[model samples]
Target: MKLYYHPLSGHSHRARLFLNLIGAQHELVEVDLMAGAHKKPEFLALNPFGQVPVLDDNGTVVTDSNAILVYVAKKLKLTDWLPDDPVASAAVQKWLSVAAGQIAYGPAAARLITVFGAGFKPEEVITRAHAVLAVIEAQLSGGSFMVAASPTVADVALYSYIARAPEGNVDLQAYPNVRAWLARIEALPGFVEFRKTPVGLAA
Candidate 1:
């Protein structure tokens, strides 16, 4: 398996982190985002969106970070990562949506502004970040993992940007439950980190 990615991208990190967690044999092929390599013809052929973290398993191609997580969990038969129980699976999907929606618009968007000079209002995104964090903190108050007792794809989906929220000046100090959740994920075997940036409050 080959993973086309950029080290600093949280999306890329999510995919890479899961691959490691599952003990999947793979090679990392860094896409030079700095050089606009992702926008080039060759890379676009893999994903027209010109995004990093596209996975190539033999001839099969999987694009989008969340999609890759689903594919890997199913392909590797990691049933625990994605349960068969209807309600449990729906719960997992709910968090995945959070990761893609609120988390994306909030902490992830704020990080983009600082880390990549993306055009977005810091105050707006930071406010959004806290709103999402509040919900997550309450949800995690009595649970170690997001959906089930053990780690799931939902945890993997939300982990990267939330773990790095401080890079966007969104402090994790007030969210004790969320912080504990992050620590729990870090303690898992084969856990990997997203590369840190020297910016924002955490820096």
Candidate 2:
């Protein structure tokens, strides 16, 4: 298996964390997002969206992070991340939807725009981020984990971006439950430390 990714991308980080959680060995291929490597013909051919976090398992390529999570969770851990009952699975879908929709757009993208020169109004983005965080805070107040009592794909999906919200100047002060959840996630074995927002390349 080959993972084409950028280190700073939260989506890519989720995939990496999931892979690590399951102890799946794979070669890491860093794609230079700064150099427009993802937008180039070669990379676009691999994923039409020209996105990072493309997993090429032999000849099989998975582009979307959520899809890759489902594939990996089902294949690797079996019963751990994915639920069997239809109602329980629907419950999981709720968080997954929030992860891709609210979490991705507001918090994750806001952080990228602020940190990576993606160009967006800071106040506007931060406001949107807070709204997303509010939802998570409410959810965290009720459960030990976002989607389940135990960690699930939904938790893995949102953990990186939510934990790194401070990089976007999005305040976590109001959401103590979420902060606690972040700490819990960090304490989990195989959780790799991620560089939240690298303003510039390190020497």
Best by lDDT: 1
lDDT of 1 by residue, 1-203 (tens): 99999999999999999998888999999999999999999999999999988999998999999999999999988889999899999999999999999999999999999899999999999999999999999999879999889999999999999999999999999999999999999998998888999889877
Task: Encode model 2's per-residue lDDT on 1-203: one tens digit a residue.
Answer: 88888888888888888888778888889999989999999999999999989999989899988888888777665666888778767877888888898887777767877678777777777788899888888988988887778888888888888888887777788999999999988888888866655432211
**lDDT score of residue 55 within candidate 1:** 99
What is the overall TM-score of model 1 with all chains considered together?
0.98
**Model 2: lDDT to the true structure:** 0.83
lDDT over C-alpha atoms for residue 106 of model 2: 79
lDDT of 2 at 36: 96
* Deviation from native of the Cα of residue 111 in model 1, angstroms: 0.6
